[model samples]
Target: MSALMLDPASGSSVGLLVAGLIVLVGAVVQGSIGYGLNLLAGPLLALIDPALVPVPVLMIACVQAALAVVREHKHTEWRGVGWAMVGRLPGNVLGVLAVASLPLAQFNIVIGVSVLVCVGLSMLSLKLSPTRPGLVVAGAASGAFGTASSIGGPPIALLYQHSTGPVVRATLGAYFLLASISSVVTLLIAGQVRVEHLSAAAVLLPFMLAGFAASGPLRKFLRGPRLRYAVLGVAAASAMFLILRNLF
Candidate 1:
């Protein structure tokens, strides 16, 4: 975890600029298509410090999830959301514990592999419907990855990919909101939720809100195929980046 901590010196103006760009762009994509911020931000931030990756990313996720759920409240699938919460909460506790003891590099490797494998299966036509078992699995996986790397959307996204627009957005928004809430609790229990970091996340909140505002027009214009392809491309690249980083 120490290896993942942010270096104060590395938080230069240029680094902050780059991080801000990531937040802006990632937030737009997330706001437009229902998710992608951490997928895009985590690996990019990892280049600065892997230890630093989880907290800021989680912070942003907290904000993103809240906004998303607020925006898409009407279409949420109550059954799936309820079961997902049940499975995720305990798993999040386990994952937070892992964060204290597990190496970031190793966790990255595992999460990277999991993302690649899940995405590949989706690409291979293995449908991940939001059934009871699938929801449970996705929830548990989301909880673990959310705690471990602040990148919890892939498993849940895979499930929602084939769903209708409203269903997908509502399902994902709800899942993320709940999982993030649980992850925050776990982080607090683990004493990893720092006040300073929360302050930093607060400062970035406006950027996320701005991005969401900017995305409103674009969301109506973008079709499903275009959005999915864009998301898949980014997610695949991030997964590969994680794998290669671990390998070297």
Candidate 2:
């Protein structure tokens, strides 16, 4: 195991350790505030190893979403999630095609810029009600982005930013639970899911669980406006990171 954990930065046996710590922190954020594991972990993990993006991080996200759903089951908004998923199916198909055919570097730049622009719009009081149509649009966007980059929570999170904490967490959790399944299936069909992806996820699972365990104590401090700001801040920073990494 030590031989396998070579650090890309220090050339020490701590690459997996660093990745696990990142996952742990991201998981705590996601568990406490709902929706940030991918945004926080995806780019950093990609720096550690490009192959770790989208699939392995997504697998962990699926688990996190599932755990969130179980923890917040009573607050789940089925109607909104249903409509979003209705749009997600087709969007997921399109995303798979994009991943298969498009140039990843260009797509990364486009996605990064798009996320930053959306985050900026959100900060400017761009709010969307969680109506059926709005949910469908958000869901479709989430499916496309998630399938391509594994960072799909921002759109849905933005849509529900003004909602109560439990609702936001529960709805997004349920939505991600379903969406992650769709993404994995699509990736499997696109020949993207491999044993190594599962292996990486396994390696990171303990840290994810640990972070989630820690979140139980931190949830009290991150309510209402605090939660909203945390989501937006993380989203903006993650988008900026993606843009800089791709462009430079």
Candidate 3:
């Protein structure tokens, strides 16, 4: 059993610890700006262990999203969330099928490139509103990519790019809370989620919560355009990193 399980003092455990710290940083960014846990940490964690990619990251995201939703419940826009979910279900199913049957490397490459393109478009000042149609389309795309890559925040984040910081954080938080649930369920049904994934998430949960707690003081400093720019920069960098990591 000792050999089978990760020993805390071992190199593998150190890697896990490093991964946890990365998660902590990602959580801070998510708590401050509302959607970055997966984007920031997903790629790094995947490099540490492929099993840590989507499932474990999604589990941690569920916790982070739920906490964000609770902290900013009053700002949630249920109507928009409803519309996004309408499209998310089908997209999620398509994503799950892709994960089950398709070549994941090629699929990930496609997603990475697509996200980079979308982030580029967003940076060009093309305004995407959180309207019903926009939300549906963004939600579907988010579901598809998120289910596959665990990097779902970009689509919805770009849509609400021009909104106020609080609205962006709260609405994205709410959407992520729901979207994480759907992704987890789909992954479970598809036999992708396992006990080890849950174990890894459990080990990393404290770091996530700690980072979130630390972000409370930092959030006040990142309001207005500063917040918007920060979100865009992080999203763009993460997308680019995903593309580069997959290609090489």
lDDT of 3 by residue, 180-210 (tens): 8999999898888777777778778999999
Question: In every candidate, how many clashes are there?
Answer: 4, 0, 0
lDDT of 2 by residue, 1-248 (tens): 22223223335447788899999999998888788899889888888777787888888888989999999899999999999999888889878888888987787778778777877888887775788888898888888888998888887888888888888888889999999999999899888887777777888888999998898877778888898888788878887887888888
**Shift of residue 12 alpha carbon in model 1, Å:** 3.7
As for candidate 2, its clashing pairs are none
lDDT of each: 0.74, 0.84, 0.84
Q: Candidate 3, overall lDDT?
A: 0.84
Candidate 1 has a TM-score of 0.88
**Lowest summed-lDDT stretch of 10 residues in model 2?**
1-10
User: Candidate 1 on 1-248: residue-level lDDT in tens?
Assistant: 43223334335556566666777887888877778888777777777545446776777777777777788788888798888888798779768877888887798788888888887887887867778888888888888887887788777777777665566666777778778778877887788876556655654566777877887787775557666665566667777887788789
Deviating ranges (above 4 Å) for candidate 1: 1-11, 49-51
Per-candidate TM equals: 0.88, 0.92, 0.93
RMSD of each: 2.8, 3.2, 2.4
TM-score of 3: 0.93
